[model samples]
Target: MKYPDLFPFSWFKGFRPESNDNLETKSPLRQLADIISSSVDQIDATFKDRGQKYPNLDAPFDPTTPAEATALSPEVIHCSSLIVAACAHLSATVNIPTKLLFDVGGGFHLSAALGVIIEGNVVEILHDHPSGLGVYDISAKNGMEPTRLARLLRLLATHHVFIETSPNVFKNNKLSSMLDTHKSFDTIQSKPEDKYVGTSGISALFAHTCDEVMKGSAFLTETLTDPDIGASGAVEDCPLAVAFKFKKSFWEWLEEPRNEYRMNRFMLAMEGSAKLEPSDAILRGYQWGNLPPQSLVVDVGGSLGHIVREIRNAYPGLKYVVQDRPAVIESARQIWEKAIPSISDGSVVLQVHDFLKPQPILDARIFLCRGVIHDYSYSVAKLILRNLRDAATENTELLIIDTITPYACLDDNQARVGYGIMGTETLPPPTPLLANLGKANAVPYILDSQVLVVLNGEERTIGSFTELLKDSGWKITRVFTISGSSGKQILAAPV
Candidate 1:
């Protein structure tokens, strides 16, 4: 009856119905409040234990500080998730239905305001003005109307993004500073096309999400109601196609010459997505060091070979072949040839290969697909998996690294038969809380809608993954949950 030592302490003990936990007898509201209070206590103690103070929201963000990494530690992350989930659930429990609906429906305005500020370089403009900047001064610098800019900024300030100092004056806070590209306002103004070229990619992510995904999502109902496209499951029939009137799939549309800026922004936005997860997330599950020396590990659809480079850096003996579209392979060649010696010595090979076709590297000891499958519909995902399966030998292992969503309610069946070993258990949240941990596990659900709007894809549950792999001639062997990452590593072998 003992669970795996996944957490620091046995806090999860007695949460089940069969256990002697007293939380089950309390009112749901009280239980949620207790969850928040206890989680905050844990977070407070941890910060004090490390001789660090909890970060202040009023101050600008400083990622260079060692406390930034400490904030992302697994234990802290879990506690934070519990607090967020409990607080949100409690708020919903007490709020009026009409008011809750209004807030949920009006959420797009936040995205619109964020896009305006990021595009206007407001964060960069406010970077030097630590004290505050008046609306007129900001308008003079950015050319936006003073009153209109004030209204937009006030909206964001209300949401705790920026901070309003005095009347008509605003300053960047920690939440808003994340959008700062650190570029000079002049450079951003002069080279509009290159604003996101050398930055942290956060601004680019904001631009793409607010501009493209937000626009496309507006036609979600229309796309769903249309019989011809709704049931087709074709990427060309997605909501983006309906909103933009484009016949091509999302990737093909990005390739058009007129959309070069958008294409570049999309690429950088993906890099920003990777930054959202832990840097060592990819190394958590699989035993890369155990592979034979010089074993070829082919990274399929590996844009810029970032994942392969990380693996090669950690486990140098394993050779790699990073395959992608021609343009991506050329980009990898250009970026890596100068920076990485592995490319020069032929230890890492960059080849252009489409996953829709049969894989070329038949001798691969491991076929690694990271964050590639979720960008396609089930039909397209099947094509990618079947291709890998066709090329995989008896000894070749396939590692799929992506999010595995959990259900909201309790599940006895999945807990019993899901992809886990005898000793390790995937712990559920305590009673009176959502089984999936609700808002704490909100990223994958947000990404589900994200893929639907952008590429007609989806984040899958464990059952969905099992069905897909079974249909593609692979059998699941093990699943390893990565610490501080929404994504899990699912290892399978050719059936």
Candidate 2:
């Protein structure tokens, strides 16, 4: 009945999503790290391309290339975007209320880190980052004593944390929020009361994707897969691994961390994204008004019951249940008891069942799967569908919600994302030439070399799903999309 703006992402909003509610700007110590890293990358690229001669290193910055883009990938600077993505994972795992926590963490990480740089000054930071301190607090505990004012001021000015109002006085902005633990731009008096930037989107998720290649891209996926799991290290090659290895290995890497720093950050990132809100925002675009406010929608592999809670909120009289692994169920129980729910009135029922096993029978009118089925291999996914089919009564509606790949081919097409919950991807072979030994592109041909990398699974195209579903005795009846941007749809009937 009362759906808070369900979908709110604008693709052309230029760069990273910033709250229109602007924040007081202060330069944080971390901005220095960001700047130094940017400068080094530009010089490296330029040197590598232009050769030994420094063609009159005249104008240090090249006007053509964007300073930030040339320095670091957009993904790195867009920590806010990282929060948005992480929130989905967290909602899927823990539930929705914590979205606020993540939002705050991200925004704060930006504000505080930047604030430190502004007050201390950025120039000196570029030279060296002191012990246990980022760019901020380097001089704070002591004050310009050993750190040198000119060097420090130069770094600070270069950091651009604040624009000079007079001489050292500066202007405040969203970027400036990084400076103070509290308030006042160019004040330089003392750390604000709200200490450590008052946690927001900068939480664990930011560190996870930015630090680990495994979490951000498919390096781990590519590396773990051994296309030739066979003795000779040669095979026909597995498409599933190639298509979805990126996400699969990321979670695998997530489960394993070198230290508490890595461990805490990764968990936080995941916790941030696990919301009832569907990743594609299709829920916002479509109208559920037609359906007679169904009794309840049960989510399979639903983490932390976030989806259950969100759906419950969306359809007043309707209720929800989240089905997941025993360990995950335990985690969900813990999260719900401690935090707030994203919606009111709608209740959540938790069901623990192995997807590889059977679906628990319930009276729910709609059986929903969001980014769920994509986690399993075709055979495994089909088995999941069969389990749901066996459990569904004629009155029950089976809704399979996931990203569907269009059959049409594009010159530079990107593959759809995997469900990203629980599934494994087979490793790529040592050598495509030798490892792509005998497996044909189509089915009926057994894979000579396929090894599960662990937890990461396969991604599928609609045509691929069509064939797989047919084999499993289900027929697709209708297709749904999120205003044609991110989410997918499928209305299926049992054979």
Clashes of each: 0, 78
| Reference-based lDDT, residue 37, model 2 | 42
lDDT of 1 by residue, 317-414 (tens): 98999999898899899999888855778899999998989998888899999998888888889989999999888899999888777777766766
Model 2 regions more than 4 Å off: 1-203, 210-264, 274-282, 285-294, 338-347, 406-454, 483-485
* lDDT of model number 1: 0.82
**Tens digit per residue, CA lDDT, model 2, 1-495:** 011121122121233222323212423223323333443454556545644323221122222344423222322222222233333333334556676576534543443433334334342232232121332344553365433433443333444533333343333332333322232322224432222232332323333333342222333345445554322211112232343333233333334444444544444444443422334353553345455654667788786776565555566566677888675788887887677454333366677977668777657667777667765556667788888877777666666766543322221222222222111111221111111111112111111111222233444565676677678667665665443233356666667
Model 1 segments more than 4 A misplaced: 1-21, 341-345, 417-424
Residue 320: error of model 1 in Å?
A: 1.8
- Tell me each candidate's TM-score: 0.92, 0.46
Best by lDDT: 1
